[model samples]
Target chain A: MAAMIERINVLIQYKDLLRELVVRDVKLKYRRSFLGYLWSILSPLLIMIVMTIVFSQMFDRGIDNFPVYLLTGSALFEFVNSSTHMAMYSVLDNSALLKKIYVPKYIFTLAKITSSVVDLVFSMGALFLVMLVTRAHFSLYMLLIPVVVIQIYLFACGLGFLLSAANVFFRDVQYIYNAFTTAWMYLTPIFYPIEMLDKMEWVRWIITHLNPMYYYIQHFRDLVLYGRFTDAAIFWGGWLFSFVVLFIGLFVFKKTQDKFILYV
Target chain B: MSEEYIVDVENMTIRFNLASEKVDNLKEYFIKLIKHELMFQEFLALKDVNLKVKAGEAWGLIGINGSGKSTLLKAICGILKPYKGTIRTVGTIAPLIELGAGFDMNMTARENVFLNGTVLGHSRKFMQEHYDEIIGFAELENFQDVPIKNFSSGMQARLGFAIATMVKPDILVVDEILSVGDYQFQQKCYGRMNEMLQGGTTLLYVSHDINSVKDLCDHAIWLDHGVVKKSGLVEEVAAEYMNENR
Candidate 1:
């Protein structure tokens, strides 16, 4: 408990530095592009359009509001995808500064996650535009979107901590993660309906019961696309999975961080 | 942990394991570990070192290349953990070890000032208050909006030094940053160091210029291959170091 409090104090003390790092990341990410910040919204919109054209005809399985459904899953998964990838390299990228100064190492990973959160917010603008064009119902349940976002943020933070520390010792973690995320996206019901796996009951059970992203994406689709309240079990399950990963990530990261300077 | 000593290091040792082969990937490392084929040659960077610095003292560390001068400074600044023993330091430390290590090349000079300042643990309000002073000190008032990548190496170094020394830190760890800028700017940096030293800030400085070490430090330690060879008055240590080199 004392250790946890100390960590929080460090976070609060270095909060300003964290904000600066996030701003630098968000700015540099778009500085060279002609579209600049517009690409945040446009990139996801374009991806949604292409996916809709290619998959809509094949998996039209009587699902209502397919674009909104596809986008909610895509945007949420993209947040997890990009944030983890960025965080995995956060420690390695700042090896120069890390070797010289005493800034808390975890701050780099936190900044990457925060900046990706900022991008996720902008992508929501695209999601909203699509929802309006498709005339999807807007209900009070949409207010709970932030809750789902917080849960997934915790989940990604866990993975970020784990990956960033592991990357320092093994540079191959980044390439392996890239391939893993691609496979993970397919496993999650992003561009297709979950019912399509009805013939395989065990796979459906595993996805619903074991996959953390499935719960998050489903919670998101519930609030945003279906305009209905989520099941209490699903909500609690999301929090449980997120906290489990977060604690494990923090554990692995803390155990290995002291040796980072030597390797980095 | 005495209050009189602002910096205390006792029986500290730093070890580095030189891997026999570069096993960067996990698969090869695991395979080597399982087969008991992984070998590491132990290299001691600093062995059983002890030092204490009182408040308001400027101590110079003189050594040849790879004598573990930078390693000791890094250990004191809490950047590297001691492989054995303990290091205790009081108050905040501003490390100028390799200035501009935190600067993003693509960001403008003005943005880098705030970014680097925050990295050094200064609040935004503190940076905002000292923004004009930093820009003026670095003499880059005209190029504030230009990306730092376009700035000459000297200009970037100047900006880094200005921000780091803007506030009087309780402890300042400088590692050969004075060699970057022009002679005039080096003079300016020395002047700033003198001012801070007079204000009761403890300084741990590492530099190759023996003349500057003798000029700026009241006490000095000569390190030979991770061991303290001689220490005491700056004149004696500097004379002995120079005599041996000649």
Candidate 2:
């Protein structure tokens, strides 16, 4: 407990640097593009359009609010996918600064995640517009969306810490993660309903029970598209999985951080 | 444990593992791992090092390449964790190990001043309070809006130097940063450092140029092969190091 408190204090002390790093990430990301912040919204909208056109006719079951369904899955999954990929390079990218001075090492990962969260927030604006166009109802349960967002953030942050630390020692972790996310996306049932695989219930059960992103994305769709909370089992399971991954991420990052300077 | 010793290092050791061969991808690494073919050779960067720096004392570290001078400075600055000992630092530390290290090349000079200032742990309000002073000192009044990538290396160094030293740090770790920039700007930096020294900031400086060490330091240590070969008054140690190297 004392160690946790001390770590929090260290984070509080370096808050300004963390803020600056996040700002730099956000600014540099959009600086080269002509549309700047608009790309955050447009890119996802464009993807949703392409995927909806490509997959709608084949997989559209009796699902209501198909646009919101597609938007929620793609937006939230992109949050985890792109955020973790960016976080993997956070420490290695700042090797020059790491060798020069002492700042809390985790700040880099946290900053990268925060920048992605900013992009995610902007994309939420696009989600709201889609909800209006599709005439989706906003229930009181929609307030629960914030809770789901926090869970996803924690999940991404945990993976961020773990991947950034590992990448410092092993340069190939980035490529491996790229391949992993591509396969993982198909397994998560982003564009189609799991019932389409009812013939393969065992595969559906594995995806539903085992994959954390399945839980996160499912909760997101429940709150936004279905207008309700996930069942108690899944709600608590998602939170538990997020915290466990966060625990492991912090554990590995703290244990291996001191050696990062030597490796990088 | 004395109150006057602002920097204390005792029995500190730093070791690095250099991988024997190139394994660029994880496939090769995993193959080596399963076959027990992975190998690492341990390199001791600093061995059983002990040092103390009192408040207001300016010390120079003189050494040939690969003698662990920069490693010692980094250890003091808390950049590298020591393998086997304790380092107790009593005050705020600013390490000028490399100039413009935290900069984003696409940002304008004005933006990086704030960015670098925050990276050095200064608050936004603190930067706001000293922004003009930093610009004035760097002589970058006209180049504020220009992207730093377009600036010459010396100009970037000047901006880095100006922001880093704008406030008096309680303990400063400088690593060969003064050797860059034009001669006139170099003299100006030296002048500012002298003023800071007069104001009682403890300084740990590492340099290859013996003349600057002799002129700027009151005490010195000569490190050779990861150990301190000689340490004492600046003149005595400088003479010993010069005689040995020559």
DockQ of each: 0.81, 0.68
lDDT of 2 by residue, B147-237 (tens): 9999998999999999889989999888999888999999999999899999999888888899998888898988888888888789999
> Tens digits of per-residue lDDT for model 2 on A130-209?
99888889888888888988999999999999999989888888888999999899998788887887899888988988
Give the C-alpha miss distance for residue A189 in model 2, angstroms. 1.9
Q: State the iRMSD of every prediction, in order shown.
A: 1.0, 1.7
Task: List the lowest-lDDT window of 10 residues for candidate 1 chain A.
Answer: A58-67
Candidate 2's DockQ is 0.68
After TM-score superposition, what is the CA distance of residue B151 in candidate 1 from its true location, in Å? 0.9
Q: Give the least accurate 10-residue stretch of model 1 chain B, judged by summed lDDT.
A: B16-25
Which parts of model 2 have CA positions greater than 4 angstroms off? B22-25, B34-39
| All candidates: TM-score of chain A | 0.97, 0.97
lDDT of 1 by residue, B1-246 (tens): 377899888889998888767677899999999998677788889988888889998899999999999999999989889999899999999998575688988899989988898888888888899999999999999999999889898998999899889899999988999998999999999999999999988888899998898778888888888888887788999999999999
Candidate 2's displacement at residue A14, Å, is 1.2
